[model samples]
Target: MPAKDKMDKTKMVTCTAPVNIAVIKYWGKRNEELILPINSSLSVTLHQDQLKTTTTVAVSRSFQDDRIWLNGKEEDIAHPRLQSCLREIRRLARKRRNDGAAGLDSTGLSHKVHICSVNNFPTAAGLASSAAGFACLVYTLAQVFGVEGELSGIARQGSGSACRSMYGGFVQWIMGNTDDGKDSLAQQVEPETHWPELQILVLVASAERKPVGSTSGMQTSVQTSCLLKHRAESVVPGRMVEMIEAVRKKDFPAFAELTMKDSNQFHATCLDTYPPIFYLNRVSQQVINLVHRYNRHYGETRVAYTFDAGPNAVIFTLRQHVSEFVHVVQHFFPPETNGGDFIKGLPVNHTALSEELKQGIGLEPMPKGVSYIISTKVGPGPCVVEDPSQHLLASDGLPKECV
Candidate 1:
């Protein structure tokens, strides 16, 4: 006889959401339930180019149980963050149904959501995977269930930064004063079309993988790192103002300065942690030096760099400087001489593609082929796409039983 199985036996409902990158990072939280941050953070909406997660969330009575397939692999739905979002969304959904807002045509849509997410890039490689995943998950769920009212408010309960991911271009996560977190949500400051001249070049650092996850690392820092207090109180508030003004004015010099400084300070706090979590590897460090030298050599700031939970670099520059930035980053990673023997899931370093690894260690001119480069720019905020087939899960709002 076949082994017994356990899961909700029902059909499924489906939807998808894009990822986003922050200009002013969301580092810590104030309210966990409402997913409110201690301070306001801003972000540039990353274009859905090479890096993004396509999540199809489904719900239905035919489904056996709640399930998620991220990048084609089934993931445990036991994480507290995941659990909280699901519970909250479900509660809101029931309210909507009882309120008669649920569309009569789709009666089973609100019951269950089977989420299937595929990240175009490596998830563990640390390019803000959770930000994209949670944002997409929440956005898609709201759409599938026909639940309404301020989508960002719901997304916030998923992750502090996730709210910003709901929109593209310049976004602000308002640090609202509501104790219930009802007022704390993300709003679009500007659309991607407002900054067409800005360009982003992502530098893939060591594919070796991150040593510390952001959630755990942040918790550790919050508990032990004293500098974090100063950062939260004094540093970020001023930097947020300057960064916003710089974006508004398109001031490269000021933008670069604040970005690099904030990044360095964030990393410094990481070092201040008792266990000392190292997110940036030697390659990431070299890229930092390389960017510094590029700006110095040019006699002005032409580019800016920001890092998320991982060491991979997101370089911001005007369209005018993108060719120069791309040329410099691309030469850092070329194909290995063995020709096509490269491995997936393994971290790729700037030096691995470089001919001379030792000499390429510092701020020296980047060797050709040391790194892989992707060119994208800011994008717009979240919008609900009406087509159901676009969703990842079954029409019944569940993952296909086969998957």
Candidate 2:
């Protein structure tokens, strides 16, 4: 091919983004199209090494039209949210060019794009996969187009929680009151380094898809649940303040308590909705009780559990408590049901559980309640993958591997 043709053939970028679990949940949306939340919320971005989505965006003149393949399955690119993200990114690029900021060739700017994204973890598990997915998508698209600066707003249009995944460490989605959502944006409260001892565990209660999707669930809650309105107005603002303070101070108990309370309230609002949506099941309830029992046995809050639109539990604790918590989890949700290790990802230090300690909590064993546990910690935000080997798409703009 000619040099110019080769140059226009494929320009690509790959990026990875980490999933985040809200400490003070963002349950209701004030604006569905803009994805503006009713109240500000905070979350700890989980380590990318354990839970994340890797995405590649390639724009080539030869490509016929915009397309996307998620987890190797072709998906409609015309999805309203996806279109929103694409429109915003292209608009930014066009604005920059018209303003004489910087510009890529017009053909490259207008060329169709092929996107491939895959999550290392199970998509059906309801692990806020969309948060990381959209963050990476917007980030990679911006990189390919050579546009930079605040992009959480663009990601927010794809998924409300996605905006927070744009930053690493501790982040907050400020619920701006402006009608246009111009002030509604995600901000970083602290870098990942601020809390070295803070650890996170994902307790996989059930990998199956959530019964109620967040979009419809929140819509129903907004229309039917008065408790949701109350929490959005009366509860979340205070929790956001305390959660930020607790994170900054690296106060485990304060953070843990706040995390648990907010999660419980989020679920409570779900219950309050007409024709209640149940995200938590027997296993989820058991995990909640076990966490409280373990903390009560120690007479202190060493662990906290948060659920995000699913039955799975995202546990937060400090490094010192990780080993014991894993042991406790293993004891209650025995791996014998699956005939394998209950723990995956970051290895836990072997600790002999005192029979007395296990007996003290006095909870009946719920074998196979949890499929497995992913041990991880707070980590950085979206990142560009420089290595060619990591790209999920080929030079021809086709997926390299299927998930």
Candidate 3:
């Protein structure tokens, strides 16, 4: 093959992005295309070692069409939400090309993206898999196209909460008022370096998939739940201010109060929906009650608990208190439904677990299939990695190690 002919082959770029957990949750969207949230939300981006996705995107002449391989499996590229993100990034890259000497070669800028992503944890583990996936997708694309501008804007199209994942540590997704959703993007409140002592404990109630997805669940809540209207109109506005201040001061009690309240309200809104969607399972409820009782007994809030669109609970505690929290919760995880039988059973989700959790913490082994846990902390925003060969796609723009 001639040198020019060989150079006609496609090129690839690989990037990795971390997952994030919202302190101020984004439950609904005002604009689907732009992924404009109904209200602003706040989150703590986790360290990459704890929970993250590594995605490699490639663009090449040898590829036939846009395709995706999620965790080594081919998935249809038909979701409008996913496509909206990719489309926006491509549009921006092309716009940059129109300006001379933007540094990106015109030929490379025009290449179609073929993305392949894999999470370090189980996608079925009831964690925020999509959050990491979409965030990584947009972050990686920005690297491939060499686009200029704040990446948070691009991540918004992928997932409203994902904008926060573009940065690590403390982040806020500002709900911009513009009709185009240009100003409604994420911003860094503080870097991880500022609060290096914060800790997160994921209490995996059940590894099973969530009963309802956040997108559809939020839509149902919006249409049927009057309480949701009240939250959007009344509650979140004030809580947002409070949460920000709490983070700035490193005030755990204030942060815990606001987080617990916000989570309860979110769940309540889910219940308010007609034919009400139930995201929390019995085990989940048990966990909540246990946390509430622990706080009451301690006479102060040492830890905060929140749930996304799943039964699994994500707990936020100061690094100083993490050991105590873990010690107390560990006893609640018994290996069997009851003693001596040794038959593995799921963790008890009964409402009467207040006494059990307090007295039983660390005494029992976690019940079989009862839980999976990941301990992690706040992380930094998205970054541009220089190596394109690290991506999941091969030189030919096909997924590496596909089934």
| Best candidate (score: lDDT) | 2
Q: Which sections of candidate 1 miss by over 4 Å?
A: 1-14, 32-34, 102-106, 332-371, 383-391, 394-403
Tell me, by TM-score, which candidate is best.
Answer: 2
> Worst 10-residue stretch by lDDT in candidate 2?
335-344
Alpha-carbon RMSD of each model: 6.1, 1.6, 5.1
Report the lDDT tens digits of candidate 3 across residue range 1-403. 9977765766666667887878788888777777788888888888887688988877775566788989888898987878888888878878877766445766765555688889986574457787788888888887777776787877777777778888888888889899998899888888898777678888767766677777788888878889988898798889889999999998889998898889888889899999798888877776787687677777778888998877878888877776556545554555333433321122222233356446643233334423445678887766656865465766666776752
lDDT of 1: 0.69
Which structure is stronger by TM-score: 1 or 2? 2
User: TM-scores of all models?
Assistant: 0.84, 0.97, 0.89
- The 0-to-1 C-alpha lDDT of every candidate, in the order given, reads 0.69, 0.90, 0.76
lDDT of 3 at 382: 63
Badly placed stretches (over 4 Å) of model 3 are 1-6, 124-126, 335-357, 360-370, 385-389
lDDT of 1 by residue, 25-71 (tens): 67766665566776778788887754566777655566677888877
Error of 2 at 197 (Å): 0.3
User: How would you encode candidate 2's per-residue C-alpha lDDT over 48-103 as one tens digit per residue?
Assistant: 99999999999998889999999989999999999999999999888888877844
Candidate 2: residue pairs that collide: none
